[model samples]
Target: MSNTPIIEAIKLSKQFTKDGDFVLNSLSLSIPKNKFTAIIGYSGTGKSVFLRQVLGLDRATSGIVRVLGKELHNMEPAELNAFRKNLGVVFQDSALFDDQTVLENVCFPLKEHKRSMSEDKRKAIGSEKLKLSGLNEEHFNKFPEALSGGMKRRVALARALVLEPKILIYDEPTTGLDPVLKQKVDELILTTHKRRSSSTLVVTHDLPSALHFADHIVMLNAGAVLFEGSVSEFLKSSDNLVATFREQGLNKYGKN
Candidate 1:
């Protein structure tokens, strides 16, 4: 993996209301290119908020966020739209359109951004991604409601891959999965990262999953980084917070 950062946040802060405490408090971090980086923390520690800053979905209260070397908050609408084409996001809820078929959901990005492309070409690409995500041909014509939780997650992943993004952002990818299914999803994510060689950032509460699959691990507390290093470093850290977090993770999920 490159030492260069694909996403950089310098003293970034965000507050939803004038009197509210900062959701992200002058947070500064960098995600290395072509690496699988997992951002882990307790709920409400601003993990998801940080994701919004990286995606340019919300403006920061102060500081800056740069993605692919461009200042995200300063980009023009058209420029931001163009830049977003390089990113693919898998939301926590899967966010599949219940009204659309699996194939249609996967092809949605192509329809919106590559409007000039022929329908047949879009379907071809969508079908390829769906298969890569472990879905069979029979699942293509079904709606989201007809699928299982794992199947829905796979479809969401397929849609994310359809755009062939340089950066892949996943929010709580294994939120509701059973242990076996969670492991499968984790393996699928690692396999996809290797196959695409994309820079991946996953915001998750699953410490065991992070420890098992991440090239780099970042821990957050009260919207600031508590620890940032390799999985071994995280595992061996002497910091109280890191130690406590590691212990809790081990107690809950067993050893890595």
Candidate 2:
């Protein structure tokens, strides 16, 4: 794998209003290619904002964001749309369509992007991805409403992987899950990363999960990067912000 970053933010900043505080205050970081990176931070600290910038859902107030070697802000609408196909995102709430069966939900992306693909091909790919995400054929016909929280998340992940994206992004993936479910999700993420060899980025407050799965860690504070390094380097850092965050994580998760 290339050592070059799959995503790069150079002095990136985002402000909602002219006088409003910047949500991303000149943040800079590089997410290594084909690695698992956990973006950690407290609420309202720009973790999601940074994700938006990366996805090109929100433009920066200043500076630049480059994903897959292309500057996001400079991409035209159609260009950006094409660029987005390289990314797969699992949302915090699973975001599954309640009206659709698990199989149909997973096939939606193929329908949208692979217009030339036959229905059988789409279904085959969808089924394969769903299985990869740990959902068996029995769950394929069920609606999202019929599934548990963990099952719903698995469906969402299956849909995300249906595109065979080079980069996979997860937003607060373990938000409401119990400890057992959270560990399952974490393991599922790692399994998928290893299987697909995709660069994975997770924005989460689940500190224990982050530390357990991420090869690289980035912590944001007040819209800026407080720390970015390997997991061990992060743990050993003498930085006050990092130390406090680590302590709080340990206390909350009851992990040493």
Candidate 3:
């Protein structure tokens, strides 16, 4: 893996209006290539806001976001599109097309991005990704509505990987699932990341999952980064806020 960060945020800040408080306050962080990092915080502490900035879906009020060496906010539209092809995102909601079958949903990206790919080739790639995500051929023709929550998550994962992106992102991936389903999804995430060797970033409120799976942790509080370090460091933190917050997470949701 490269020493350089695959994604870097430098002095980044975002505020909806001139007088509004910043959602992300001067945040500077780096996500190293081929590593798994987790961002954890309270619901309204700007975790999702920071994630949107990372994807260039939202522009920062100040500072820069660099993804794969390109400045996201400054990129030309065409350049950004090309750059985006290297990243894949799995949203909180599976975001599957209810009208489409699992196979079609997985093949959607290929159809949009690789227009020259033949129909057979697209289906072949989709099948391969779905299998990699722990789904078998039996589920291919099933619509998203016919699947369980865990199955839907697997389909979303398959779709996200269809493009073979180097950077994989998950936004509240385990949200709304029961404890059993949540564990299944968490294991799937770890397995998929290890198998693909992609740099992964997860923004989650589930602290136990983050502590169990992340190589590094980024904690946000009151619109600023309160801590950034290894899981061990976080657990042993001297900051009362960090320590207390961690205890709460462990107590409420023990590691899988």
Predictions: Cα RMSD each: 1.4, 1.2, 1.6
Tens-digit per-residue lDDT, 118-159, candidate 3: 999999999999998889999999999999988998999999
> How many clashing pairs per prediction, in order?
0, 0, 0
Quantify all predictions' global Cα lDDT against the true fold: 0.91, 0.92, 0.90
TM-score of 2: 0.97
Clashing pairs in 1: none
Report the C-alpha lDDT of model 2 over 220-240, residue by residue, as the tens digit: 999999999999999899999
Error of 2 at 247 (Å): 0.6
lDDT score for residue 11 of model 3: 90
When summed lDDT is taken over every stretch of 10 residues in candidate 3, the lowest stretch is 247-256
Identify the runs in model 1 with alpha carbons over 4 angstroms from their true place: none
Q: Model 1: which ten-residue window has the lowest total lDDT?
A: 247-256
1 or 3, greater by lDDT? 1
